[model samples]
Target: MATDTLNANVLVLNKLWQVVDICSVRRAICLLYLRHAQVVVKEGGAFYTFGFEDWKDFSRNSRGDDFISTINYRLKVPKAIILMLYDRLPPRRVKFTRKNIYLRDNNTCQYCGRKLRTDQLNIDHVIPLSRGGKNTWENVVCSCISCNMRKGNKTLKEAGMRLIRKPRKPDWKTFVKNRFNTSEWESWKDFLDVAYWNVELEEDK
Candidate 1:
């Protein structure tokens, strides 16, 4: 029970209250103890912030399975925390990787348009590497094993195949939504709005 409580997921927000990352309960507690973060509690459609000592007091009367017991007291495992100083997210880019490619394409074959399990999918080079195609977002797409085999090392015209859609770099907002859509943590949904986090920076004129 103790181990499970410490390893439970805690949604982390920046000082601006924008969803930033997901961390372990242990990390969240450490941050709280160090005065680097505060636990966020929601009640009656409003959110409240609590410091370590305050949170300890808040947990005293709380009865639930989601808590850790120490020698002196029990601490409720916090569902979310806000970093006291972290106000900016690092510059964002959807990572170029096979898994991201599958996500961008929705795990559906570009040529045959069949959605397949990961085991049945392959990352295909639209213009084969043998033909000097670079491994890039616009060059690679998800393909089923059958379509991959059928289009092996051949140009679309040569293989008598055409793509359903042209692959492009995925939008950052879409990528964030798809990557961090935490359905299990209902509290997180209130903070994961793209409009909140994706505010465009005003440029100096």
Candidate 2:
């Protein structure tokens, strides 16, 4: 059996709010005002208490309205830590992949404002790679297969097409979505916004 005394980080909660991160169960009991209750085991020696029950007991027995209550606790391991990690940096250059091009142009066709699916999309270089344009995020946008096929190896001007919007490097939030794990993003949504993401590009000028 796994040792119950293993030191693990825990999320201390009170009803709907997350109160704190506790390094150990003992610390959570003492420092977070949880009671030392017990649960009966079939072997009759080992026992445990519901963390929530302990908090309720502590709150009821306390002298004043300053009672504390914890709703739940979840063990925090390396996987949990990984899921919570977030970075606030932007990518140096955008890749010439379908996802990056779609994200860079907000899933809209560069020649038209209509939305397109991943399989239905194509990456188009604004300046045409054949004509000194590099395959960078700032120079790529999503295009329909027809637009891509028609514009092959030629500048938009040469293809007699105009862009609905100029392609530019996305800010940090878009960059993060393009590269980071989805689980890591939940904790970061509150800190990142569309404007915060676009601000860095604005400052580049």
Candidate 3:
């Protein structure tokens, strides 16, 4: 009887696009059952779940137990399932490049903070690569072509240039948007705010 009970509660993950639960080890027994199982939440730290349904319905015509029951007898709450609520970590921060730095800085030259279009931007290494600075998020920024040329292979101090703002990693929301192209991710946007994305940095500071 215990084994039967466990089996009845088991839920599985399905591959079909209409399916919602991705981490479940068991599948809904039938299409009707699948449809009836409400999407409780999206799996991840990100609060992507919205417009989900709950598990109750009533016949419109009857109020005093006159309605016919449509629910299946064997259907049970999903068990052995760890529903993913949100992304556990923020999306990875990409290494800064000329193009990305421009986007992050809104096409503004970091040295002077003057906005420019794509053609006028150049990638500048905060610490010259010759001095063992790795190509990474912290060490790159966008500059105008003239500024970049004047600062070539020289430290900021050497070139007499100063950053208008410190270059740091972007938050998870931006990172995810940059990395993946899908409407599916739109549901999670509200949860990935600047505060949530910068949680780790806040802790470190």
TM-score of 1: 0.68
- Give the runs in model 1 whose Cα sits over 4 Å from its true position: 103-121, 125-139, 153-177, 180-185, 194-205
Candidate 2 C-alpha lDDT tens digits along 21-130 = 22444454453333322211111543223343553543354353322233553322111111112233333343446665576666677886678777888777788777
lDDT of 1: 0.82
lDDT of 1 at 82: 96
lDDT accuracy of residue 201 in candidate 3: 26
Sort every candidate by lDDT, greatest first.
Answer: 1, 3, 2
lDDT of 3 by residue, 1-205 (tens): 1333333322222222121222321342233244533323344653121111222221232244211233442222332222233223322344444566666676789998788888888788899898989777778888998999999999989999899999877654564455433543463344344353443321111
Per-candidate TM-scores read: 0.68, 0.45, 0.45
lDDT, residue 167, model 3 = 81
Model 1 per-residue lDDT tens digits across residues 1-205: 4786788788888898877788999999999999999999988988999999999999997887778888888889898999999998644556788898888888899999998898899899999999999777889999999999999989999999999999887765556555554543365666655464554432112
**Model 3 TM-score on a 0 to 1 scale:** 0.45
Highest-scoring model, TM-score? 1
- Candidate 1, after superposition: displacement of residue 156 in Å? 6.9
Q: Lowest summed-lDDT stretch of 10 residues in model 2? A: 76-85
Pairs of residues clashing in candidate 2: 39-48
